[model samples]
Target: MDGQREREGRAPRRWRHGPPRWNRWGDEEPRPRWPWPSTVLVTAFVLFGSNLAAHAQETERAGLDPFARALLFMTGAALLWRQRYPVPVVFGTALTTLVYLGAGYPYGPVFVAVAVACFSAVVAGHRGAAWAATGTLWAGHALVAHWLYRWLPPPGGPAASWGQELVIATWAVAIVALSELARARRERWARERAERADAARRRADEERLRIARELHDVLAHSVSVINVQAGVGLALLDTDPEQARAALSTIKDQSKEALGEVRQVLDTLRTPGDAPRAPAPGLDRLPELVEQAASAGLTVEVEGKPPHLSPGTGLAAFRIVQEALTNVVRHSGSRHARVRLGRDGDTPRLRVDDDGPATGAEAGGGGNGLAGMRERAAALGGTIEAGPRPDGGFRVLAALPLDAKPATHVKEDDR
Candidate 1:
C-alpha cells in the first residue's frame, strides 16, 4: 500500500506541503481535496453500481450464480487507490474484466472500470502502462465478442468486427488525449505558482534591505551626535560646569529624537499593506538639521535654494547631508563644515566640505555610512562623489533631480 501511494501522489499520508514526496502527482502544493483521485473513485463507484445491478438481473433470468458482481465491487474499490498505484490498479482491473467476461455473465460496461484506471495511469505519467492496458483490453474485448458470438444472433460480416475495432480504438485514443491535456494544464498551473512564489520572495528581500538601510541611517547619525556631546560634557565637567551641563542636555535631546526616528522606521512593519504613510524628510527640515549640528560644535555654513522637490528626492538629499555632517564630526575632527545646496538647471546639487585628513574614517573614505549615502543617491537616479579635496579636506558632492530631469548638461563623477 505504501509503495502504491508512493507511485501515485499520496502526500506521505501526512505532512502535506506541495505534491507527494516523489512529485509523481505534479502536486507540489496539496489541495484540500485530491480532485483527480476523487474522480477515479467516483468513476469506479458508478461502474460498480451499474454492473452490479445488471449482473443481479442476469442471475435472476438465467439462474446462474455468477461471481462477477462481487468481483466488480472489488475492482471498483481497488480503483480508489488508482492514483497511488495507477499502473497496477489498471492491470488488476483489466484482468478482472477478462475473468468477469469469461464467466458467462452479462457484459454491462465492466471494462469502464478498467478504462478509468487506464486514464489515471496515463495522467499520472505512466504512458507505457496505460498503452499496455489498452492493448490488453482490446484483445480481451475481441475474445469476449467471439465467445458470445455462438450464444447470440450474428450481426453481419467482417464490416461489423471492423466497426467494433474502430469504436474501441477511438474511445481509447480519446481517453489518452484527454488525460494528456489535463496533465499539460496541471504542469502549467505548477509553473505559474512557482513563478509567483519566486517573485514574492524577491519583493520581501527588497523590503528587508530598505528597512535595514533606514535603521542604519537613523541610528548612525543620531548616535554619533550623542557620542560627540558626551565627549564634550566629559571634558568640561570640572573646568566649565555650565558648558558640561549644556552638553549633557544636548545628549538627552538627541537620544530622544533618535528614539522617535527609530520607532517610526520600525512602525512601518505594522502599517497596512497598502496604507498611505507619512512623507519622507525634505528640505523644509534643513534649517533644523543645520541648527542641531551647530549646537554640536560644528561651525556649519548652509547656502542653497532648493526647488520644489518630491518626497523621495528630498529624503535622499536630507540623508546625504545628515551623513556627511556626521562624518564631518566623527572623522575629520574639524570645527568647521560647509554645506552648499542649490540648483544648476534641472539638477539639485549638494556639497559638504570640511577641513579633515585625506585618509582615515574622518573623510568618509571607507565605511558603511558612505556606501549607504551612495545607495540613497543611486536610488533617486542621481550620482554622488566623496573624496579628499586638494586643500587637505574631505568633500561630498551629490547632484540629484528635484523631480524631472535637468534641462542643462551636468558633470557627474559617480565613482
Candidate 2:
C-alpha cells in the first residue's frame, strides 16, 4: 500500500499519526498539521454560552442538566474534524443539535457548532451532504416542535412559531451562499497560480535554447579555424618555419577569441539579470570574420555593404555567416567563398556561397549548425534556404525583415 501510494503521488495514511489534517477550507497541501486551537475555543464558547441561554429561558425550557450538557458538548466537539472529515462532522453536529432540542434544551450557541460544520463541509466540496444534514436538522426540529411537543420535555409548551422557522431557513440559505462565494474565489486563485507557473516554465525553455545556439555558433566557428591552422602548422613545420609560425599565431588568436566569447556566455548564466559584459557580435564585425577565414586558408570576398539592421537582426545575420563559413571549412573542398549583402525594400537579404563538391563524409545537412541558423531566422519571423546550388557550390540565403516579430510557429527542415 505504501509503495502504491508513493507511485500515485500520495502519502500513505499512518494510524500512529491519527487522521490526516487539512487547511480550514480543506485545500490539499504538501504537509498537514492538526488544527486544534480554534476547535477548542469554539467548544468552550458552546459549553459556556448554552448555560446562559438555559438561564434566560429557565421557565420556557428545561434547565441545563447532565444529558443536555452532553448533547451540546457532542455538537461542538464534532467540529474538531470539520476540515478533514467535513461530511461526517456536519451530519454529526446536526444530529446532536436535533437531539438537544428534542430534549427541551433552550436555543443558544449550540447552533454555532452546526453553522461551523456546514460551512466547512460546503467549502470542502461537499455541498449536497452539507445541505442534507442541515435540512434534516431543521425538518426534525419542526416535527418535534409542532407534532411531538406533547411527548417531549417541558410538557404543555406551545409549538414553535412559523416566524421562527422562516428565520432559520433564511440563515441556512445565507450560510450556503457565503460558502459558495468563498469557494469560487479560492478556485480563481488556484487558476492564476497555475497560469503563472506555466509561463515561467516557457520562459526558462526559451532561454535555454538561446544559450545553446550561442555556444554552438561560437565554438563551431572558432574550432574550425583552429583545426585548419593546426594541420597547416604541422605540415609546414620542416618545409617553411616562418609559415608554420604564422599558422601557430593564427591558432593562438582564434583560441583566445573563442575563450573570451565563451566566458561572456558563462557570465550571463551566473548573473542572468545583469547587463552583458560586452555587446553581442553583429554584421559590423564582418571584417573580423573575413580576416579569421583568411588565416584559416579560406578566401572570403565581400560583395556589397550590409544595410542597417536592428541589434537582434544584425546578430542573427552575423551568426548565419559565421556558421556558413564554419561549414565550408569543415565540409567543403572549396578554398574561396563569396558573401553578398543587399536589401529588398525593407527586408535585409544575406547570401553565402562557396564553389564545392561537398566532402562525402558530411554532405548531408543535418547538423546543429544548420539547425541553429534556422532557429535564429525563425525567431525574427525570417526564413533560411540552405542547400547545394544547381551548378556547383553550397548556398545559404536568409531574408530577415526589419520589423522583427517572433513567429508563433516556424516551419523548418527535419534536420
Q: Rate the local accuracy (lDDT) of all candidates.
A: 0.72, 0.86
Clash pairs (backbone) in predicted model 1: 18-28, 18-29, 19-27, 19-28, 304-341, 331-362, 346-406
Q: What tens-digit string does per-residue lDDT give for candidate 1 at 1-415?
A: 8788888977456554444443533435333344456655655664656556565765422222446557767667767678777889888988887666555555566667777788888877788898888788777767656655455322321212668767877887787778778877876877788788788887787678667878877777777778778889999999999999999998899889888877777777886484435667777888877877887788988886755778778877888898888888777757799889787787889999999763234322334777777777776678878988998888999988666332322334322
How high is each candidate's TM-score?
0.73, 0.85
**Model 1 misses residue 336 by how many Å?**
3.6
Backbone clashes in model 1 = 7
lDDT at position 210, candidate 1: 65
CA lDDT of 377 in candidate 2? 95
Worst 10 residues of 2 by lDDT: 23-32
RMSD each, Å: 7.7, 4.5
lDDT of 2 by residue, 132-193 (tens): 99899889998998899999988889999989988888887888788778877876787677
